[model samples]
Every structure is written in structure tokens, then in C-alpha cells.
Target: MKQELTELLCRKSFKYSEEPAFKLVSGRMSKFYVNCKPTTLDPRGMFLAGHLVFDAIRTANVTGVGGLTFGADPIAVAAAFASGLKDQPIQAFSIRKTRKDHGIVRWIEGDLTPGQRVAIIDDVATTGGSTIRAIERARSEGLDVVRAVVLVDRQEGGLENIREHVADVSAVITRDELVEQWTATARP
Candidate 1:
């Protein structure tokens, strides 16, 4: 499953260059770029990602899975769906980038309550800033963030950085793995 997902990402989402040509969210130029939405939104990609992420957190005893919106949304939903299919039944939640000012104002939107155990997820971790923010917001809302998961680790210390907040941190795929698969497929 991992192998298949890697190939799909390499073909549909991962991009590479001999020189740093891609601008990251952190405003840094990178030789590699990955926009997982193209892959994560696809049926097969969703299936692979759902199963993989669910496998990663199924035993963590978390009642919910989620993270900052947009990037983490699809993966979280997919994982939650996979969990239900597998009979684990974890809920999916989304954290807003801006605080809601309306009635029942909160940073998160889901069927979760204060103190519910949950895992934070992200599509890509570059500086771990977004995931860290998600973790902080989750904590602020009184959710117990026990684990963090990255769909793709940029291999640029993001996971290491995330580990500081949550001891249990993992990535389904690394930038290196995508690069390797990309290189292999690019060749004759």
C-alpha cells in the first residue's frame, strides 16, 4: 500500500528540480515540492492514505483525528472513514486558522469535547509550524493531543520539531522516499 501510494504521489503530486525552484509556505526555496491534495483527493490516493493513517493511529487509543484545516482536512476525514470501516470509529475534526467569533466560539469544529484524546495530522510538515499551531490550538480547547502524524515529512527536521510537543510523532512518507520513487520512475 505504501509503495503504491508513493508511486501515485510521485506521478501526481511530487515535483523535483536540480536547483531549488519551488517556494514553500515558509518562504524558502526548495528543490522538492509536494502538493498532496492532488493525490489525497483522488479515490485511490484516499484509500491508500486512509488505510495508512488509520494504521498509524488505530492503536493510539484516540477518539478523534484531525489538525489545522485545508492540509489536514482530507487526510483526517479519510482516516476517520477508514477507522469506521475497520470498526475503530475515530471521529474527524478541523481546526480553524482564525478563531471563530460567533456563537459557541472555538478553534475546532467537530463532534469532540474537551479532554477527548486525539491525534493531530498534516498533509506536509516543512517547519512543523502548522502542526505545532494545530497542537497548540487543540490544547487550548482542552483536547488531549496524544500523537501527531504527517502524511509527508519533508525530512527537514519538521518531525523532530513536532516531537518536542508530542513525544509520539510519525510520517506516512518522507521527502526522501518520494524523491527516490520520483528518481526511479524518471529514469528509463
Candidate 2:
């Protein structure tokens, strides 16, 4: 499953160049770029990602899985769906980038409550800034963030950065893995 997903991402989402040509969210130029949405939104990609992420967090004893909105949304939902199929049953949640001003006035949307164990997930981790922000926000809302997961780690200190907030941090795929797969298949 991992191999299939790697290939799919290489073909559909990963891009590389001999020189640093891609601009990252952190405003740095990168030799490669990864936009997981194209892959995560696909049916097969979702299946593989769902199972992979579920496998990573299955033993964490988390009742919910989620992270900052947009990037983490699909992966969290997919993991939740996969968990249900596996009978582990973890719910999915989303953390808003901005606070809600109406009614509830909350940063999270889900069937979760304060103090429930949850895992923060994201599609990609570059500087790990977004994931860290999610962790902070979750903590502020009274959620217990026990674990963190990223679909793709840029291998640029992201995991290490996230470890400052949560000891348990992991990535389903790394920049090196994608680069290796991309290089292997790019040969004529």
C-alpha cells in the first residue's frame, strides 16, 4: 500500500527540479515541491493514506484525529473512516485557522469534548509550523493532544520541530522517499 501510494504521489503530486525552483509556504525555495491535495483527494490515495495513518495512530488510544484545517481535513476524515472500518472507531475533527465569532465561538468543530485524547494530523510538514499551531490551539480548547502525524515530511526539521509540542510525531512519507521514487521512475 505504501509503495502504491508513493508511486501515485510521485506521478500526481510530487514535483522536482535540478535547481531550487519551488516556493514553499515558509518563503524558501525548494528543489522539489509536494502538494498532497491532488493525491489525498483521489479515491485510491485516500484509501492508502487512511489505512497508513490509521495504522500509525491505532495504538495511541486517541478518541479523535485531526489538525489545522485545510491540509489536515481530508487525511483526518480518511483516517476516521478507516478507523471505523477497522473497528477502532476514531472520530475526525477540524481546527479553524480563525476563531468562530458566532454562537459557540470555538476553534474546533467535531464530536469531541475537552480532555478527550486526540491525534493531530496534517497532509504535509515543512517547518511544522502549522501542525504546531494546531497542537497549541487544540490544547487551548482543552483537548488532550497525544500524538501528531504528517502525510509527508519535507525532511527539513519538521518532525523535530513538532516534537517540541508532542513527543510522539511521525510522517507517513519523507522527502527522501518521494525523491527516491521520483528519481527511479524519471529515468528514461
Candidate 3:
């Protein structure tokens, strides 16, 4: 089922065209980029992912999900939708890279109280820096983080680094799995 999820994401990504380039958080550049926005931000895929997330969370005994903005946004949205479908009910939250200089001057978004148990969800985990930062912010804001779920894991030591801060890290696909699948199919 997780493999199905990864394949779906790979198919959903919008390919780059003309002078294509991307600087991944892993510091790797490739002409082929997985523009997840096409898959995650879409209506159908979004709905499907939401249901999948809700199913996974049913066993985690978790209450909420959150992470840094952008990459994590889609999954958080999915969680929100799935929560409704599962009748499990969960909220999505967002963390800022830094506190805003103005307005509410907030760092965490959503209904975060000082001692809520929440889960972290993101599209990808490369270096784990962003995940760590989000966890830190969540802790400071008083949330008991149960675990994390990344749509794709770069298999680049990110999982280990994240363990220091969060309960556990789960991924639908790892970097090795991605490479293996890509290689297996490319040998035409």
C-alpha cells in the first residue's frame, strides 16, 4: 500500500521543462524534479492521500499533525480531510522557519496548546533539519510529539537525526527504494 502511495506521487509530480534544474534540500541537483504540488495540491490525489493518512493514524493513537510549511502543507491538509472521513478527527498545524516580526508574531499555526499530543507529517525528509526545527518549535509550544511520517525519505541519515527530537520517523518510500524502483524500470 505504501508502495502504491509512492508510485502515485511519482506519477503525479510535474516534470520540469527547458533548462530544468532543482536544488534539493539534500544539496543534490537534477533535471528531473518531483513537483509534488501537482499531485498533492490536486483534488483527487489530495482526497486519496487524506484517507490513507487517517487509516495510518488510527493505530498511532495520535491527536494532531504538523510540520514546516510548504512541503508539509499538503500532507497536513490530507490529514485534515482524512480525519473527517475516518471520523477520527485530527487537526493540521504549520510551523514557521522563524517567528514573524509582526502581526501575531507567531511560529506555530493551528490549535496548539501547551501539552497536546501531535504527530508530524511532511512530503519529504532529506537532511532532517527542517523536521528537527519543526519538532523543536512544537515542543517549545508544549506539544507531545508522538511520531512522524514523511511521504518520501531520502535515506540520507535524516531518520536517525530526527529520532533525537521526535518519537519515530516513518516513510512511504526510502531513497534506496526509490533508486531501486527507478533503476528497475529504466532498463529498457
Candidate 4:
């Protein structure tokens, strides 16, 4: 499954070049970019992602999974659904960038409750800002963020930065690994 997912990502989501290099959200130019939307939205990709995430966090004893909105939306939902299929049945949540002005003025959406262990996740980790923000909001609500996970880690020091606050952090695949795979397959 891991090999298959890596290949799919390399073929469908990963792109590389030296000239006119890709621009990252962090405002840096890069030789490659990974847009996980294609993979995360695909049925097989979504299945593999959920299972991989569930496998990573299942040992953490988390009751829920979530992260910053949009990027984490599909990931969290997929993990939650996969967990249910596995009979673990974890909940899913999303952290809003800004608290709603009306109603409960909540920062998190979904069935999350205070004092539950959760694994925060995102489609990709560049600077870890989104994951950190999600952690902040979750912690504010008294949720224990036991682990942080990303679909891909750019290995650009974001993981180290996040480790300053989070003890457990992981990425299913690293930028280096993807690059290696892409390089290997690029040649005839």
C-alpha cells in the first residue's frame, strides 16, 4: 500500500523542475511541489491515506482526528470514516481560522469534546504553521493533541519547528523519499 500510494503521488500530485521552480506557501521557490488534493480526493488515494493515518495514530489512543480547515478537511473525514470501518470509530473535527462571530463562537467544528486525545493532521507540512495553529485551538478547547501527522513533510525544518512544541510528529512520506521515487521513474 505504501509503495502504491507513493507511486500515485509521484505520478498524479508531484511535479518537479529547476527552472521556473514552484512557489511554496512560505514564499520560497522550490524545485518541486506536491498538491495532495488530487490524491486525497481520489477514492484509492483517500482510502490509503485514511488507513495510513489510522495506523499511525491508532497506537496513540486518540478519540479524534483533526487539523486546520480546508487542507485537513478531507484527511480528517477520510481517517474518521476509515476508523469506523475498522471498528475504532473515531470522530473528526476542523479548526476554523477565525472563531465564528455568532452562535457558539466556536473555533472547532464537528463532534469533538473537551479532554479527548486527538491526532492533528494536514495534507502537507511546509512550515508547520497550519498544524501548529490547529494544535493551539485544540489545546485551547482542552483537547489533548497527542500526535501530529502530515500526508507529506517537505523536510524543510518545519517538522523540527513543530517538534519544539509537539513531542510526537510524523509524515507518511517525506520530500526526499518522493524525490527519489520521482527521479527513479523519470528515466526511461
Candidate 5:
């Protein structure tokens, strides 16, 4: 089941899974790019990943799931839906790159209550800067961010930085493993 979940996520995240010279949001030459919308926008991929993520966080006992907007949005939504299916629906939220000037004037979105345990999600992690900011916003709102769940970890310093605060992180695949599998299977 776990292997199946990983395979589907790899196939669906084609932007990163198939490309090798993606220009990352960090302005660095990423070995790959992870545009998870392809998967999130697909029903099968979303349901599979949602169930897997929810089960993964079962031990974490998280009250909410969220992270930086854009990439993490779909994953957070999926997890929240899975939680609902399990009859333990969890709150979902997001962190914007910058706070909107009008209306809410908040950097963080969703129900912003204090002291909730949360798990952060993202499509991919390379430097962890964005993830860190998300964590900061959540913490500032008094959310106790317990762990991070990423679709892919680029096997760079990103995981290290996140671990400084989260200690334990979950990912569907690492850069090394993804390349290894793709190389072995990608048709010529």
C-alpha cells in the first residue's frame, strides 16, 4: 500500500518527477520541480494521497494540517477531507508569502485559534525557507506545529532546517529515491 501510494504520487507530480532542470521558487537550479496541482487536481491522486497522509499523521494526533499556500494547499485540503471521512475532521489553514493589505490582513488563513497542534504540508522542500515562514506564522498564532509532510524532499538542506524545529518530518519520496526509481524505469 505504501509503495503504491508513493508510485502514484511520483507519476502524478510530473513537473518535478520528469524534469531535471527546474527553476525553483528559491531561484536555485532545482534537480526537479514539484507542481503537485496535476495530482491534486486529479481525483484518484488526491484520494490516495489524502488517505496516506491522514494515516501517516495518525500517530502525530494533529488537530490541524496546513502550510505555505500554493503547493501545500491541495495536500492540506486532501488531508482534511480524509480526516472527515474518518469521522475526525481536522482544520485546514495556509500561510501566504505576504499578508494581504486589505480585508483579513492576515498572513495565515483559516481558523486561527491558539494552541492547536498542526502538521505542515508542502509539495516539495529544498531550502526550507518557505516552510519555516509557514511554521513561524502558525506558531505566532499559537499553533504547536508538530511535524511536516512533504510530497518530495529534495534531499538538500531543506529537511535539515525544518528538523531544527519539527524534529520529525514525513515525505512521500526523497530526491535520491525518486531519481533512482525513474532512472530504472523511465523508457527511452
Candidate 6:
């Protein structure tokens, strides 16, 4: 399953460049990019993502899964959706970058409450800023962030930084792994 998902990501989402390396949100430059949305939003990608995440958290017994919106939205929904299919439903939640200022006037959306155990997730972790922010928000809301997970870890100190706050941190795949796969496929 892991191999299948990695191949899917490499074929459907990963991109590489050497001339003007890809510019990252963190202001860093890289020779490759992993736009997981193409895969995460795909039907098969969604299924694999959800099932993979469900398997990762199955033994953890977290009440919910979530992270910063946009990036984490589909992944969280997919996982929650998969969990339900397995009869062990876990709720989904999303955290906004800022408060709505109107309506609910809150930062978090969905059926999340204080003091629940959740695993924070992100599409990719370059510097871990977004993931950490999500963790901060979760903590502020009184939720216990038991795990930090990402679809891809760029391995650029993001996971290491994340480990400073959360004891358990992991990624489904890494940038290096994708690069290797991409390189292999590119060969004659």
C-alpha cells in the first residue's frame, strides 16, 4: 500500500526543476516540489490517503484528526471518511489561520471540542511552521495533540522542529523518497 501510494504521488503530484528551483512558502528553494493536492484530491488518492491515515491512527485512539485548513482539509476529511467506512469513525476538524471575525468568530471549524485527542496533519512540512501553528491552536483550544503527521516531510528541519513540541511525529513519505522514485522513473 505504501509503495502504491508513493508511486501514485510521484506520477500524479511530484514535480522537479533544476534551473530555478521551486520556491517554497518558507522562502527556501528546492529542486523538486510535491503538490499533493493532485493526488490527495483524486478519488484513488483520497482513498489511499484516508486508509493510510486511518491505519496510522487506529491504535492511537484519537478522537479526531485535523490541521490548518486548505492543506489539511481534504486529508482530514478523507481519513475521517475512511474511518467511518471501517466502523471506527473519527471526527474531522479544521483550524483557520485567523478568526472569522463574524458568524462563529472562531479559529477552528467542525465538530471539535476542548480536551479531545487529535493528530494534526498537513499536506507537506517544509519548515513545520504551519503544522506547529495548528498544534498551538489545538493546544490553546484545550485539545491534546497526541501526534503530528504530514503527507510529505521535506526533511528540512521541519520534523525535527515539530518533535520539539510533540513527542510523536511522522510523515507518510519524505521528499528524498519521492526524488529517488522520480529519478528512477526518469531513467531509460
lDDT of each: 0.96, 0.95, 0.73, 0.89, 0.77, 0.88
Per-residue CA lDDT of model 6 for 14-92, tens digit only, reads: 9888664888886768787888899999999998988887788877779999999888899999999999999999999
Candidate 2 C-alpha RMSD relative to the actual structure = 0.7
lDDT of 3: 0.73
* Global Cα lDDT for candidate 4: 0.89
Candidate number with the higher lDDT (4 or 5): 4
Model 4 poorest 10 in a row by lDDT: 18-27
Write candidate 1's Cα lDDT for 5-24 as tens digits.
99999999999999999998
lDDT of 2 by residue, 1-49 (tens): 8999999999999999999999987798989899999999999999999
Please list all clashing residue pairs in model 1, or write none if there are none: none
- Give the clash count for each candidate: 0, 0, 1, 0, 1, 0
**Model 1 weakest lDDT span, ten residues long:** 179-188
Model 3 over residues 1-188: C-alpha lDDT tens digits?
A: 55655566656762332353877756777544555667778776677666666665657777788788988888787878788776778888888877877877778888767788888777777678888888888888888988887766767677888888875677766656655555555534
Q: Please identify model 6 stretches exceeding 4 Å from their true place.
A: none
Q: Candidate 2 — what's its lDDT? A: 0.95
For model 4 the local lDDT of residue 106 reads 85
Preferred candidate (TM-score higher): 2 or 6: 2
lDDT of 4 by residue, 50-156 (tens): 88988888889999999998888888999999999999999999999998889887899988788999999988888888889999899998899999999999888
Query: Over the full model, what C-alpha lDDT does candidate 6 score relative to the true structure?
Result: 0.88
Clashing pairs in 4: none
**Model 6 residue 84 CA deviation in Å:** 0.9
